[model samples]
Structures are given as C-alpha cells and as structure tokens.
Target chain A: MANEPDIQSDSLLTVEQAIANLQGADLGLRVYAAWWLGRFRVDAPEAISVLIAALEDEDDRTEVGGYPLRRNAARALGKLSDRRAVSALVQALGCSDFYVREAAAQSLEQLGDRSCIPVLIRLLNDQVPGTLPAPEPPQLAQPFDAILEALGGLGAVDAIPLIVPFLDHFIPRVQYAAARAMYQLTPSPQANHYGDRLVKALANDDLQLRRAVLADLGAIGYLPAAETIAQTLAENSLKLIALKGLLETQLQHTTPPNLSQGAIKVMTLMDELL
Target chain B: MTDSLVSLIRAVEDADSSNRLLEAVENLAAARLEGAIPTLISALSYNNPGAAVAAVDGLIHLGETAVPFLLEQLDAHNYTARAWAIRALAGIGDPRGLVTLLGVATADFALSVRRAAARGLGMMKWHWFPDNLLEIAQAEALEALLFVAQQDEEWVVRYSAVTGLESLGLAIVQAHPDWRSQIQSQFEQIALNDDSWAVRARVWMAQQRLQTESIVQPRLEEQPSPLSETDWQMIIEKLYDRKGQERLVFAEGDPRRYRELVVAIAQNPKPV
Candidate 1:
C-alpha cells in the first residue's frame, strides 16, 4: 500500500453542509468538502461562486495532504461545466501551484473553451531545472502532460510544431504524451505526417510505446491503422481498446473494403471474447 | 527522466537475476511510473515478497488501466504471479476482475491465493457499468464468496470469506435494497455457528451493521473490519502465526466461550 490509500466511501454530507464545510477551519475537511462538492456535481449558483473563489486559495500542503483545496476547486469547476468559469480558469493558468495550474488547464479543456489555448501553450515545456525556494523540499511544477493533453483536448492545431519535438525526449512518458498530443493536434489522418510517425511507432518493439501509439491512432480515427489494430486484437489484454479504436476507424471509411472487413472481423472476435 | 529511473524500467523487463529484477521493481515503484504497469505485472512471478508488494502497489497506482493486464496474468504458469495478480485485481476492485476473482476464490490450490480471491470476490461493486452486467457479476461474486465463507478448509480463508461476504452484503444493501433479508440471514447463520471467534465477531458486526441504520459509522477501528487495511494486516499476521494446519477445535465446541471472548474484545477499550 505504498501510497494508494484503500479509500472507503466517505460519510457524505448534504450540498448545504458540504458548501458550508468549504470554509471550515480544518484544511482536511475543506479539501474533503471541495472533492465531495465536485463528486456530487451540485449546480447551485452559490456553489459555483464559492468554487471559483476557492481557485485563488493559497494552501500549499500537498506534501501533507494528497490534494490541495484550489486544485480540487478547479476540478470541481470543470465538473460543473459552466462556461462562466472560463476567465477565472484561464487566469488560474498562472497559479504558482503546479497542480492548481494543471487542474485549471484540464478544466479549461473540459469546459471546451478555445480561448485558453494560447495561455495553456505556455505550459507545454514549463518544467524548470530547480526547486522552489519557499516550498521546502522543493519540487518543480511540471505541467508538461497536463498542458499537452489539454492542447490535444482543445484541438489546438497550431501547437503541433511545439508538441513534435518532445516525441524524442529521453523520458518515455514525455514521448507518450508527445505522441498523444501529436494525434490530437492533427486535424485528420491526412492532415499531417505525424500519422505516419505514429503508425511506425505502433510497430516499435516496446509494448507500452506500441499501446500508446495504438491508442493515439484510434483517437485520431486513422483508417490505415485498422489492419494493425485488428491484428493486435489477438492479444486479449488489448482487445477491448483495439476493438473500440477499430470501430472508430471503420466508421470513418466512406467506401468499405479490406479495412472495413478487418474491422468487422475484429468486432466478431470482440463479441466472442469480451 | 532520471537515468536511474529509465535504467530501472529496463532492468525490470530484462534483468537476468531475481535480485536484480526485484531491486529494479523496488526502484520503479519508488519512481512511481504509471507507465511501468506491464513491468510490474511481469515482476509478480519473481517470488520475492518485497518485489511482489512493489508490483502490487504500482498496479494499484495505475488503477483502471491495470485491470485487463492483471486479468491476463491470472493465466500465468507461476502460481506466485497468479496470487499477486488476484491481490492486485482485488485491490483495484474493478468489475472486470470479478470473473477471474471468482474462479480463483473457489478453486485455487494455494490457501493464500484462495484467501486473496475470496477477499477480492467480495470487493466487486459494478456501479460504473450497465445494470445487467452489475447484477450478473455481483450475484456470481456473492455465490463465490458464500462458498468460501461456509466451506474453506483453513480458518483464515474462511475468515476472509466472511469478510468478503460482509463487503458484498454491505454493497448490496446500499444499492440493491432487494437483497437485504436474504443476505442478513446468511450473516446471522455464520454469526451463530462459525468456528472461529474472529470470524463470528466479523459476522456479528455485519449483522449489527445491517440491523442498524444505513449510514452507521464503524464503532471501532481496531476490530477486524474488511475495510480497515491495518486491521486486516493484523488479522493476517495473527492467523499466520497460529498456523492452520489443523482445524480449530473450538469451532465445533460450545458457542458461549467464543461469543464471550468476542464480546470482551469488542467492548474492551484496549487495542486488540
């Protein structure tokens, strides 16, 4: 149980009780209430204003508490899906807390606001060389994946050039993120050369890397990937996602042929296996 | 990425020595790489407790994505790997893990594996999926858990089975209100006749929880409740120390002695 707590269902409070606890004296209670409010997804106008106000909260006890109040607040705002939260979330991109900034970027994506694209693009390579001075046992605020994912989720096509370089980064996770972001920024399978690059990565010997690229190809609805994804369905672990992706690609094909046939075969296999 | 982190991931996948592989598993876990899930699933066969634990923790961190890979590992030739996979799948509590969990809970040769399966089988609460799947999985899981609770040879396994039943019972009561009286009778039967004081206490507690309000907080943290990690760990340590090679003599004897001991423990202020 290194760090993953065996979470039990919390004794939940009502909306009014939880909203009241948002300003409670105990930081844990406040954070718990913030999460509960989000989990419950209450749409009270008063709740939205309070959650928005909580975005500016300065509690920096992440080392002590697993989640910061502001991060939970940002996440709650996103769950609300209220467009009124767009400007505050955009400004939250500049929050000193890395997680708070990440949460805001993710919420902006969920809110489906294109206005925050330029603001989020700045966080694509935000990891610095050293730790902060104030937060003891300092940690760098790496917003790299959140930013890439947000850019992808927002369909920021102009950010493709910015995302492509990270595909060769020494970190495998960075490469994975870059591949996913590349797929997201590419408007269509025919729009960019990244599709070919991803297809090549699908044949890469690394299982994790191959799976990552396969998921991206699926997400982009790359029709040429139908054959490869269909073959991968032979591995049961990859079957569910592979079938999902192949079906997505199949729907994109206007003229049914070998690609559509392959998808049909895979779907039959899924029906038998899943 | 740190050079050590990348090296550890590589070593976990390709190391020639068990020691090297185990060390690599520990390092990868320390780095907390969610991408190292496949490596962790592979490391389960090493038969090193520390490495198995690290792998389990890593899989737990990966959460939902780790479910299918974990389910695949149930077919591993190594029983050790299968055991760890059952534990990890149980820890994740995903509905996808239910079928394998039931298979292992009822038929695994190893007591530890069966115990893990029994405990895990009860943890299945399929709220995320369609009601049809949820109803099917939950009913099958309950059937498997009930089998282990009533018939497992080892007292420890039976104890875990009861806890599993309790967990499934609580989930059913909370969500499936229709399953209340039937599950309550099952708990009361175990409470009245279970051989072990610990198992009986667990059943009584379940009965009490069911008999009481829907939202009653646990009265004691030290008690061997299914949800408390620390208490479960203690129960496991205590059970393993006694070594259940022979059946409990008191299991078939007077119920009053076991009942009194359970009451004293529950009512006492001191920690167990």
Candidate 2:
C-alpha cells in the first residue's frame, strides 16, 4: 500500500548502529549512545520508528537520549509528518530528561500540520515563562529555542497566538526568538507588537544582543524594519552587515533609489550624533 | 585562566543566555577534565551565586584536584564558599573532609548547613573514606548516626548517613541488637514513605548492593571425582582392609557423562 522508495533503512545505519550498540552496553554508555543516535533521526525519516521504540524503554538511562538527541528525533519525526507518530512524540514530552522534552516540542513544530500548535503553545509558556527554576549552572537549553526556530522555518502561522506574548520576556534571548518567529509566521496582526521590540533592540547599546537582533530581522526581511536597518548602516559605530542586508533585499525587489534616499535621512542623524 | 575559560566566564557575566557557557564549564570539571583546576577555582569567587554554584559543581566534578582548594575554603569568610567546599570534598570521597565535617556537625550553623556537612562525611565513607570507616561507624559516629538516623530535617543527609551506616557492616546497630532493631524501626519511616526523591534514589542503590552481595559467593562448593577402579585397583586394595575382591570393577564409557560402575564381589563374603 506504501511506496518502497520511502522505506529505505540503509541511509539510517547511523541510527541502527547507535541503537544496536546502545542497547547492548551499560546504562550510562547506553544513554550517551542513545542520545547520539536520536540526534541522527532528526534528519532521517527512517529513524522515526526506531526512536518510537527508544521512548518506550523503561530504563531511564537506557532510554533517555538527553536533550540534543531526543529533541531532534521529535523534530525529525515531525518533519516526516506522519500523523501516527504525533501522539508518541507528545508522550515523549514527558520523558524523564528535560532536554528530551524540549526536543519533543521542537519536533512538533517541524510537523507544521496545525494539529500540534496548541500543545506547542502550551510548552512555549512552560519552558520560557520562568515557570521552572533553571537547572543549576544553566546547561545549554537549545531545544525550546530550536522548536521556535522550526516553527518559523516551517511557517507555522498558527504559532503567532503563542509567540507574541513571549516577546515581552525580560530575558533578551526569549524575546528575540519570539520576535523572530513572529516575523517568519508573516502577516499575523500581532507582528507589529514583536516587530516594535526588535526595532528597540536594534538601538540598544549592548552590541552582541543588538547584532543578534538585527540578524534575525534581516533574515525575516520585514520591509517595515527597513528604517532600523537604514539607521544602523549610516552609523560608523554600527556594523556594515545589517545595512548591506537591507540594501540587498531592497535592490533585489524594490527600487534602489528609495533605499539610497532612506540612507540619506539616517546619515543626517549620524552627522548630528557625532 | 585559559583564554577559552576566561572568555566563557566573561560570557557567563555578559551572556544574554547563561545556558551553554555554564554547561561547558561544568562538564569539563565533572569529567575531572584535567588542567581545568585553576579556572574552576577562580569561578568559585564569581559574583553571581548561580555562577559560583556552577563553579562549585565543576570543582566537585574535578574531585581530588580540588582538595587543596577545598582545604583553603575550610577557613573562608563566605558561607556559600565553605558550604560548597564541604559538599565537593564529601562528594569526591576524600578522607580529609572528615575533620571539617565532624567539626561542622556540632557547629552552630544553619540546620541545613550542619546537616549538609554530616551527610557529606557519611557520603565520603561510602565513596572514599579510609578502611576505618567501619570502625568509625561502630565507635565515635554513633550519636551523629543516630541524629541522622532519626532527626535530620533533610533526607539526602539522613538517607546518606543511614545507608553509610548500614553499608559499614551495620555495626552501629549490630553491636547491640535490641537497640539496633529500635533504630531500624524508627528509620523504617524513610524506607517505606516513598515521599522524598533523594531518599528513594539512595534506597534503590542500597537495596541493589544488598541483593548483589547476598547472591554471590567466593568459592565453588563441589568435590572431585574418585579414580576409576581399572586405573588403580591394586593401589586401592593395598590401602583397604578385607575388601580386595571388591576393590576392582570396569566400565568402558565416558567417565564424565556415564560414570557409574559396580566393583567386584568380596572374596571374604563369598567364603563366609
């Protein structure tokens, strides 16, 4: 009933090798190996079924792949977009490992089929809204952020309902991610709320967070953000990268003369600040 | 500090997100990632409690290399520094921590802090204390063991002390059985309650060791097979009294698989 071409396991040897070796070793070894194999599944559809089995393993050390692997497997399975795998991934959000739960969230975004939007919106709140005390010494929390990125890349327009409120986060990373995700889900009425904050970030004195914000804006190509980009380009203090990006987009699509004119206004302001 | 470490520590202060920087440093220490000792020591003095806590964990992870640093902190002004050092030394199973732990157990510190020191000393006994651990368990540590045995407010400390006492041959209770039973009955509250995660985890570990020890033994209890009659009949007859005819018998099958054979009838029995 199904096509044979979609069922190949040969490309998934990395996952199989990971599984075979993991299930055979000591508990700690099994966990480390399982995590790596699960990461391989994120890009390989053949790994979805195997990952589902890993989730059912009762031994926490044997089953848990930590955050990197679990999240990717979830996202990867979602990318496969098989409706049957959705609930299994949902159950995985309850895996004992915090990172695995985070990964499950991101994978739901990759599926982008709309049915997962509600659960994901719930998770974004739990993970980002300071509901959980941060783990001691802050380990890299990539999965939740990765999920937000996936939602944007997959153009999950339904996500705007959840993504908008997080832009008000006191933590710059969460606010920056929410703003960027909102921009990617384009045409949402609430994009203005997030977009305005991004414009403010562009003017903030902290250069690193500021640069990260501009990069996201440039990536999203919000023509409304053209003013922010134009402002950065005219200042000798600001990097040429943001301006180059805005000018490139405008030149490629709109008339170049209009951008040059906008650049003139930003230059006049720069002259005053000096 | 190495450039990468200084950069990461700086990043910890300046980071928009403290997540990865903290993890990298901690993992490096936990694996006893060598040559990272100096870096982690500097981080212990960081302004942020979170960063310092993270650094302390890294130091704990470094284990023995942190001993000198831990020893130095035994006299520090910072309560947090002293507290974390006690925890790290205990976690590393270092015997040097015992004196400080013994001192702090009686010191007028916060109950949590005192409980932490007592628990750390107990943890060291299991993981790295000297052979006198069992001796210490039997003699000088009874009151503290009893305190941890019943009254400590924290379960990690309480369970650790109880389990350590149990592992050291149960001498605290064994030296006097009736008193020991009473102690066990009192602490049965923990073994059965199932309320605290720390208690449950330690219980699981303790029970696993108990089960393993009981089921394994050092020697295989089996006897070797006697020599076949055909191989040494005369030699056997010379050693035995009045059973010369019965001393020899023969079978022609594999000895290990089909080894049964009947000896010859006794000549004395036949004559009588």
Best by lDDT: 1
Q: State each candidate's chain A TM-score.
A: 0.70, 0.55
lDDT string, candidate 1, B165-218, tens digits: 766777666666666666677776776787654455456555655667565344
lDDT minimum window of 10 residues, candidate 2 chain B: B259-268
Candidate 2 residue lDDT tens string, A1-274: 0111222343444655666655564655455555555444443444456666555665553222344444444545655556667788777765656656666666665565556555565665555342232244454433456557656766777777777676675567677887778766767576666677777788665556776777767655455676665554222223233433443444444341233443333322322211
Query: Candidate 1 — what's its lDDT?
Result: 0.65
Task: Give the Å error, residue A54, model 1.
Answer: 1.2
Q: What is the TM-score of each candidate against the true structure?
A: 0.46, 0.34
Clash pairs, model 2 backbone: A71-A103, A75-A107
- Per-model C-alpha RMSD: 17.5, 28.9
Q: Which stretches of candidate 1 lie over 4 Å from their true place?
A: A1-8, A11-14, A39-46, A59-67, A125-142, A187-274, B1-272
Candidate closest to the true structure, highest DockQ: 1
Q: Write the per-residue lDDT of candidate 2 for residues B98-184, one digit (tens) a residue.
A: 555655654524443464555555454332221222233233344455566465554434644655444433333324565455445
